[model samples]
Target: MRYVSLGSGSKGNATLLEHQGRSLLIDCGFSRKTLLQRLELARADAGQLEAVLVTHEHGDHAKGALALCEALDIPLYCSQGTAIKMDWTEHARWRSLTGGDLTRVAGMSVAAVTVPHDAREPLQFVVEAAGLRVGVLSDLGSLTPHVIAAYQGCHGLQLEANHDPEMLRKGPYPPGLQARVAGPYGHLSNAQCAELIRRIDWPGVQYLTAGHISEKNNHPDLVGQALALAFGSTSRPVHLLAQDQVADWCEF
Candidate 1:
């Protein structure tokens, strides 16, 4: 299996995963033109997308989903709440998915995992194909036991380390905004991310990509350092997905 991140941050987010002659996009937050360009960088064709999976209805994650699926004539999968939250009557192909059910999309086995987020029915995904497993986890405020179990044996992981707690506390965000971000239903902090990594079974996680970093409140170095401590002396490679640059393709 192979994967690449088109981009990851508060601005937007998308990921491309391919294996066993099938390709899938985890999110489609970029513009159609930018999405095409990023796919081209990975030598992938947008017309070949098997499915588009949405985690939530947040603009940075769901903004371009309809446009991309409509343009490619591909099916979109998300929770009923998410579908209802969308202007789905305007689109023809959409499938509502519930957590814990396994579905095949473009030859890949996709299992949706519920996540705690501000959205009504947000979900993360665990994808398996060609004897490899990839976990896509983001936009969650906290990790549930179900989330940890879902990602227990992933070969490649794109996990969120959205911000630094201290930075968030001392940063310039207003009181209400800060409360929302630091609340139980907000994004994860660097320390929380590191603790989660420490608890997970990491033997199968050969590649780790920290994603959805805060451009204003967190530094890539902080994320790297925290993860490095959690992954001390382990051979696994940890990468930070940039907000602008597309991550290099990695295979497992």
Candidate 2:
């Protein structure tokens, strides 16, 4: 399995996962033109996408999903809440799955795990193919026991490190915005993200990508430092996803 991040941040969020000739797009947050450009940079052909899995209805995650799927003539999967939020009329191409149900997409067995995000019925995905598994956890306020168990044993992980608490505390966001960001259903602080990495099966992971970092509240250096703190002396290669460019492919 190989994965490439098109971009990951407040500006936009998308990832492409491939195995053999099949490909799955985790999100399409950017505009169609921009998504195509990024996919080109990632060396991914959008035509190979078998399906698109949306994490939630947030604009930065789902904004371009339908357009891309329509252009590719592929299916788009999301929770019922997300579908309703989209108000999509293209019922034939939409697949709605409840959390915990497994489905096959592009030769991978996919299971959606409900997550604590501000969006209605948000979900994270764990996809497995040919004995290799990849877990994607992002846009969540807090990490729960369910998150840990669901994400354990992943070969590749894209976890959210949205902000540095100190940066957020001193950042320009107003009081209400700060509270929302730090709230239980907001986003993961760097410290919280590191703690979650510590408790999960990190050693088993072959690749770690700290994703959805805030340009205003978090630094890429801080993300690495925090993750290092979590792994202690047992450090592993970490990849940082950027909002403006595609990340290098991580294969397992």
Q: Best lDDT goes to which candidate?
A: 2
Listing every candidate in turn, what is its Cα RMSD in Å to the true structure after a full C-alpha superposition? 1.3, 1.3
TM-score of 2: 0.97
Q: Report the C-alpha lDDT of model 2 over 166-242, residue by residue, as the tens digit.
A: 99999999999999999999999888888888878555778888899999999999998888777553657677889
Worst 10 residues of 2 by lDDT: 228-237
Off by over 4 Å in 2: 232-235
Question: Cα deviation of 223 in candidate 1 (Å)?
Answer: 0.5
- Candidate 1, 38-109: lDDT as tens digits: 899878876678889998888888889888887888899889888889867345688989988799988889
Looking at model 1, which ten-residue stretch has the lowest summed lDDT? 84-93
TM-score for all models, in order of appearance: 0.96, 0.97
